[model samples]
Target: MKKLLIPFKISLLTVLFCVCLTNAGQRRLGTSAANGLVIQQIILKGKVLSAVNNEPLAGATVRTEIASIKTDQKGNFTVITKKNKGTFTVTYLGYQTKEIQHDISTSQYYTIKLDPQQNTLDETVVIAYGQTTKRFNTGSVGRVTAAEISRQSVANPIAALQGRISGVEITQQSGRTGANFNVLIRGRSSIANGNEPLYLIDGVPWLSAGISKASSVGSQSPFNSINPSDIESVEVLKDADATAIFGSRGANGVILISTKKGKQGKTEVGLNAYTGISQVGHTMPLMNTQEYIEMRAQAFVNDKISPTSVNAPDLTLYDQQRYTNWKKNLIGNTAHLSDLQLNLSGGSDKTQFRISGAYRMEENVYPGDEADKRASAQLNLDHRSENEKFRISFTSSFSDYKNNILPTDLTEGIYTAPNLLPYEDNGSLSWSENGSAVYNNPLAATLRSYRTKTQNLVSNLNANYSITKHIAIRLNAGYTTIATDEANVYPLSSFIPNNSRISGESTFANSDFNSWIVEPQLTYNRSFGDHKLEMLLGSSWQEEKSSGRVIFAVRLQTKLDTLG
Candidate 1:
């Protein structure tokens, strides 16, 4: 056994020695082969330009299998590759991405022109948690651009979206200014759940479009605080794709609003002003005074009842010769709407800024001096580090809005008695005939108004850092607060004196909604030949605190009512 083991060990040592010699020779041979097989590489110089204007497309991405780079301000790029023939992929925002193959060994200089994307399907759309083109989006998305919105004479941006999107219903809840809106995507989602879609302003959640439903008529829309002219685009994300990103909040859908930002151009100032009048159209066809009286007499005759002061006041007690057009006097006034805006914007490609202020006012058709007035200001600041890897953007909007209008709709006034006057000889609301309670004063509701004042602030900050060519980190932080002070008043003059001692009262409500959110995300993107891959890992943290109070008082002076 010892002799056999010694022979086996010697055989193993000899095998190992021979293997070492063979590996050394192979290494030497590989070195010589590599030196001889080395390919001669050439540098390619190119320029990327716009096909329409021939303008230089700065920061355009130029990529090849061997090398990749971005164009300089003059749209020039250099690529070094060993292949004598290869393809180059050129891409820029708002332009069609193209791949052009060239003979690199024959020509060192090439000019590539990219055409602007003309199809709406190719236009980029901002979506939930990300952005993509409609042609490539996996979910249903509807987009409205700033140009389309600017052409519309609308006070709320949501109104401009009407009739523009498919399967989306946008309706005004009330005719009054600052009234809430109802938006449904693809009809109702559930039988007993809130159907309002989640709204995001610059990626920050908008808790609600209004503060509270304290008004007896309709809820005021907080969307009014966001000026329509200041918006750059509005994107609606619909279906399960949206719910996956926002959980149940986006069960109905998602709305993304991106405000305007400054561009790289000469400093410019713009002023916009518009004034118009609106009146109720097409009054209901109704019987005149003679027709109404005749109909009433015939009805009494058919019922075998005699007309009395208590039963037929229109025939016995009130003035028989007096005839009033109830609809005209109640809602015949023309409403005046006016808007004035001033904006200043200018900056370089690295940093840009835009600031604007606007004033808007809209009067109601009611008899009183009731109107909705809003003053708003917006600011947008954007910056990019010299390396173009670290980028930061800040957007903020502020507005002070006041609504002085009736709490409930005055449609009831249109069907009032056609022969009765709205006012008495003493210039007061007519409610009594011969010192007796007989009828109601439709104009009285106008005296009892619902007044509200709201101050809204929405601000956001976004930052992104590139960890590598295919990996990036992004942080989104935002803060928003809405302060609303609303009042519902009922003066004794607005009500009839019943039971000899009736009183009037008022209700005051104040609310504050404050919230903040922070989100950090890590993303990876890489292209492998014809296929592309992307990955994202993110976390979101949000906090909110709210408080409100309501108070009731009797005989409060309307002029002295102040929430401040």
Candidate 2:
């Protein structure tokens, strides 16, 4: 029994010794493996600049496996990583991202020049409801940047788009100042109704149709009220996919106009002024005195009319060697245009603002009191909370325009006989008492007064609240008001004995239009694995009201004429 106990004790002690030895070996192996997993950390310094211009890019992101940093205003960045050799990435807006694999132990300083992506595929375009990149957009959309719009000397904003956009045809109906233009996208869609595309300014519908009830001497476009200098970009939606979001209003297509906004930068002030001259491209030469006389003689012989007939002009008066070129006399040779604009813009991280004022004047080619004068002002503001969870923006514009129009049809002046004189030796309008058909004095139309004044105010407010990282609530409200006043005064001298309807007639019209809109929407965006899901649920309410009155009085009852 004593011998068996001794053997059992020896076996137990041996087992314990073997266990201790195994634990020591395992601990040493664990320590070595832990040491192998440790990595050597190093400090890296870098700078980012634009490859095209070599301009320092501030706020550029530099990321590595264990460290991330942004460049300062001087485009200098510093980062510490756990690897001596690893790839680092640099990213910036409007620039191509770059990646560099380096051994920090060998080189701690790096100068990265990021190339600019000028390809249109990466450009961002404005769409119906939001903005999208050209690469991901599946719709047919045309974009006209501010640079393109300002490349030409254009009085109307729509005219600037002529010959610039595909599938768009712009035709000027007349050469007169403030004349209407026909803009057709994808051709005419409706024969019974208007084919004009819907116009939106900063996501708010604008009144493209003339709201005035006054009688106009020629066609006028409501777009004239908006100053072209205030526009930043114009986007035209042509295909069904591009216009579908607008629903029924998009049936005729859509034009989205974006105005200038403040950017996050230092305060900037800009002034622009330009003056130009306009003249008729071509002129028709009228017949001289000798030519007129010969033509009249030939006409009489062809008609078999006796030269002594009453219908024939008196030989003594017609024989006078005098001639007048009515075309040159009525339409003049040159017109003048001038524009001046002043703008101020600036912003910080949390707030931004822009203010602009402009004045434009255009003189008529027909001389006299025919001209168009306009004044406009715009204000835009934006604010964001510290965490960017709450954001609000406001935009407003005001415009006042006055147009002095020709009182008579200029076409009639073009066809006036070369032998006829507009004024007599007594400084009064000339007239003939002959039984032959008589024509009104062409000069009277130039002297008669017809004027139109339009005033418009457009304003919009937008607010957004981020309920979560993937969900947001937004509200938009807008209001627009337009008022027009028109007047026409015909003096007694403009009247003809045969035409009694023009006896000192005066006409006046006043109109007012107001519109308001409210929209509330909730947006949800999330990603599952490699797929992304997005949704927009919204509702909109809009209201418009218009009121107008017109009055016409023949002859003045009192010295003072008032509109009722």
Candidate 3:
């Protein structure tokens, strides 16, 4: 009996010791056991102000690891933190960010001051020949930065300037993927010829304005070939100041675009990808079958004409119970949008290079195998001599896109008798009803297929050599070429078999545009007291050529842009 009791007591003692250890572990708290870092919650107050004038910034935001807070009207804020020694950042609308790290072991209040970004008067603005400050530039100019353009997130770069720039009016002509945009700078300037501003992409004159049918659904702009992601900046030169460099071509205005270049840094690769869906926001309500019948009958009575099978086929010949909502059937589906952009950039002080590739797809709202896809690539290279007196740069871009949709208008179908059906029970067109030929079928036009493929390539090379510190000579050259192929097919199902003479028809078209330019310039600059004098001597030679071929075929007629 004594031996059994002794063994039980020892076991009880060991169990008691384990419980005591567990309780002590739970009570011990100060540093995290996982990372061994001290975490003490604390709250502090701060003030945000401008560094130069010491004025309060009413809308500054202060962000820390634990909390984000904004300054009050008096530039005061309170923030909660997790550490006694902490770092935080402060930001304002037009001010440079200010960061502060403080050992708050003893202090209660912190202060932060931020500096304003460079004033607009001192900001650099790109001009016709070179860059100048906004204050010193004599001509009217408007500029948009890469950050602003990226925020728009539009496939067409022209759409980015819709409400951004004043005096420049941009209107979208279509809702298709590669839609056209009419851009008028300072209103209309021409009567017969095109009123388009000269467009330059990295010193290369582009064949974007007044393009062919392959470029857009119903318009002539071809700005889609230029990817918005590759642009570094856009400068709009308005008035006659730019005409000195480009002659009469620049009489209206000049839109100069600069692409992104490699920076002097370590090698870096970046990727941008996005996908989304779109649908019609709102649709108009149309009359139903009963209402449409009453309206048609009233129209004939008002015109003092009797309704019959020949005069009013929809009311007398078509099925009385049939109903068709043309708008919903023809243009009610969802569209898909996706894009991917990848780029590699790196270099040294003496030489730098950048390369980028992009692929984008946009689906149509029409219920068919219709979509637009584009693939593009760009490369840029820059080099400089050891003395920094001689420099050269080359830029090139290639783009190819295919569109399989036509601008077919279905407006007539919406107004047609709602009791009319476009097809029969056997999946064939319903062209006749009650011995009368029916022309209310909207699918007749949609059956015709239209496809187009376009390719564009642009290249530019610029070189500069300094004979002396005060004088330099430069040479600029560039070329742009575009090729397009289009095909349209019309089927017999689109027409009434008994009344129409055409059976089937088709058309094929090929168009090409080639243009080149060269400019050699000499510049001299010197400063006298507080004034500077500059002289420019330059000459420009440009040439453009365009050609096209078309083929039309007919069986009786065989197949189908602008809308109804």
lDDT of 2 by residue, 1-564 (tens): 998999999999999999788766655443212454734456788889999888899999999887789999989998877676888999999889999887855898999999986888877789866778788788888888888877777767898899888999988666767877788889999998888888888877877665435556456677788988889999999887555667878887889898888888999999999999887667667677677778877888899976753565533344346677777778865788899999999999899999999999998778575688899999999999999999999999999998886635575687666676667778788765234445566777766787889998989899999999999999989998888898887777777755334367778988888989898989998999988788889888888898889998785444343333
Give the per-residue lDDT of model 1 (tens digit) for 173-238: 887777888899989988777788888899888865556546746788879777999999999888
lDDT at position 287, candidate 1: 83
RMSD (Cα, Å) for all candidates, in order, is 19.5, 16.1, 12.8
Among all candidates shown, the one with the greatest TM-score: 3
On lDDT, the candidate that comes out on top is: 1
lDDT of 2 at 273: 94
Better of 1 and 3 by TM-score: 3
Residue clash pairs of candidate 3 = 489-559, 490-559, 503-557, 504-557, 504-558, 505-557, 505-558
TM, every model:
0.77, 0.76, 0.78
Give the candidates in order of lDDT, highest first: 1, 3, 2
**Model 2 residue 489 lDDT?**
79
Query: What lDDT does each candidate get?
Result: 0.85, 0.80, 0.81
Which ranges in model 1 have alpha carbons more than 4 Å from their true place? 1-114, 302-304, 434-437, 555-564
What is the C-alpha lDDT profile of model 3 across 390-410, one tens digit per residue?
Answer: 999999999998877765654
